[model samples]
Target chain A: MNMEVAHTREEDKDLLKVAGEIDAYTAPELREALVPLTEKEGNLVVVDLENVDYIDSTGLGIFIGALKSAHNYNGDLKIIGLNERVHRLFSITGLDEVIDIGEEREEAK
Target chain B: MGDAYLRLQEQYRKILNQYLENKNEQGLYHAQQFSKKVLENQISPEEVVSLHLSTLEESFPDIPKGAQDSFEFLLEVMIGYGLAYQEHQSLKDRQRELESEIDVAANMQQTFLPSGIPEPEDLDVGVLSVPASKMSGDYYHFVHDENDCLGVAIADIIGKGVPAALCMSMIKYAMDSLPEQRLQPADLLANLNRVVEQNVASNMFITMMYGSYDVRAHTFQYAGAGHEPGFYYSAEADEFEELSAKGIVLGIKRHAEFREYQRVVAPGDFIVLLSDGVTECRTEQGFIEREEITRLIRNHMHLSAQEMVNHVFHELEKLQGFQLRDDFTLMILRREV
Candidate 1:
């Protein structure tokens, strides 16, 4: 399925709320939207994957690259609102250990 | 008349031999230089053709009556040979240029790697890296923070050669620019993902493992971006386990997330990180299992970290007949109580 990203700014962080399936074909669009946000020095970024139905390896890669970019500027990127399946995917791949995933939906913000 | 014809034939034979053997511009130029001699000797193309026909007739006395046709064919063959020789020379020159370009790129890639492994207090670290070809798609790095926190990263680009090298450099620069506050493994990878997504081509991706070990806390915090799972050796249990973290590869999506995992390392506990080149080592029976790597590490566990890595590499190399099919990187982080 096609992916959609909704962007907003909250406090000092760039909030990107993404919905839809993220796979090989649609991951680039998400990358295009998120790359510029990480470029600014010390820009706090938050990604809400609550509505994301599926995430493949490609989609995961984009998030990792974005996190690196933010860190380069001394900024931070946090992921919040991962659904059960998505969280399980992270556990399976062992990415749960590498990124900041907010367990409670309220804590994500 | 006979003497002059013999002299012409001998000269033509000598020129043909020179051109065929050297197959260079100089040889062709010599032939051009001798063209004037042919004119001065009043020898026509027909005379040359006749000389060739006579030589053929000597070998086949009962030859067919198509002497003139045979001469024409021979002339065409010579012209074709000359053209092929020039094409071959140009191709060789182009190949040489390409080889040199790859050499330069390979050298540049090397500079991006850490010149020497850092030896932090109370920690033993070792690394071994080998490219499958002149260039590698794998990269490993180490950064020490002011608080004595050591950050280790091992990454693999999706492809090899110049593009992969360029991607690796971007990773290095991004890591270097990371702010102190963002030194956490998860934060570091998140920042790096943005850099990679923006700079790296859409067709390419990267897998990485970034970990930070706090000397005082004795905790190892790490994150993985679709990279291969490393191995963890727990001295208390005297067993080996997989250091598996979940994250996707870099450059695939704009807003993705990676989960971080942490473990408290005790004395005699160590972590081993490696690229797929190590786990995917090919055998006649297919890929070597992940357990093989753990076994190798276990067998050499008594040695120092560096020597252990060396021994594992040597043994794997022996298994593969000393030929690596992919970029190989192995790293070890051990704590001494």
Candidate 2:
């Protein structure tokens, strides 16, 4: 399914909300919308993947790349509001160890 | 007829007329050029054959009625065959491209055989890896160092192709770089995890089990990174216990910690390690359970290590009606006094 990646400024943090399947086809769109925010000066990026049903490695790669970019710029990036499925992806791939993924899921089911 | 078809037909007619009139190499060259244009323009071969029949018939007006009818029938048949043949050729080209991608993966993949694996006098080893398709996502490598240590690692990339092969290479090189230090499984796994997270392009994650059998100590120290649990068979107790070391799959994080598990191998005891394919073997009935796999191993306990592996593989292959849904890999490290 096609995914929607929306951006909003939450005071000091840049919130990127994504919904639908983030696969190889749609990952570029997410990267396009997400990478710029990470590169901004002192940008605190927070990605909300609560509504995202499936995310392939490419989509996760975009997150890693953005995190590196944020770190290089002396900024920080974190993920929040992940559903159970998305959370498991992070846990299994061990992204949870590096990325600051929050436990407060905005949506369940 | 549409303008495009008319233009193509006229072009085809001109080329054919020139070829018929001269009947020389120059004419044949024009024919070849016309054929290329037809394909480029997405023209069907049937249309070309149809146009050829109509154009040629115009020149042979006084032909016999029966021969004329036969030619008409042949054109009708060729219309279908010619179109189907063109489609088949197009599909064949696509098939070749896919096969070449698989070939690329196959060329890069390396799976150790029994002879290539290290075997200390106290340990009997058997290794078998078979890909269901032309390329296997599962890979296993061994490192035999100066300390009489047998360092073994088995990894399965979630995705296959050139990317999976590259991931395997990264894992292999990381493992190869160890052994010299006789590092613990946890440390080795952590180092490998870093290599995957940093170097891998984030296209795949790998589940791996890394371990070393110390010949002098008679101890097997191992760690896992979200891989299938290995089984330890106690010759004295005649019982099977699962290896408990656990961690996440590699490539998602820059750092991962794997807890190491240690077990002492005594005479006649064996350690069985396998990829998911062996445990998840599906038949018409459905996926066989982990217990079933353990039972298979128990039944073949009397056989030599390599023979046991071969028998189990054949049994699972037969159960699945000689078709494997996934790559199958199984290794046995049996201790013989």
Tell me, what's the RMSD of every candidate? 12.7, 9.7
lDDT of 1 by residue, B175-283 (tens): 8888756467877788888888787764568889999999878899999987888999999999999998878667655666778999999999999999878986877
With candidate 2 superimposed using the best TM-score fit, by how many Å does residue B227's alpha carbon deviate from the native? 1.7
TM-score of the candidate numbered 1? Answer: 0.64
lDDT (10s digit) by residue, model 2, range B1-337:
3787788888777878887788999888888888887777777765766777777777677778887677677778778777787888889999999898777667656542224767677889998998877767788877777888888888777654455566666776676675567788888889888888887664457888888998788899999887777789999999999864568777766666888888988999888989877875878886687788889889999988999999999999999999986778999999895
Categorize the docking of model 2: incorrect
CA displacement after TM-score superposition, residue A31 of candidate 2 (Å): 12
> Candidate 1: global Cα-lDDT?
0.81
Q: How big an interface RMSD has model 1? A: 5.8
Model 2 is docked with a DockQ of 0.14
Q: Model 2 clash pairs? A: none
> How does chain B of model 1 score on TM-score?
0.80
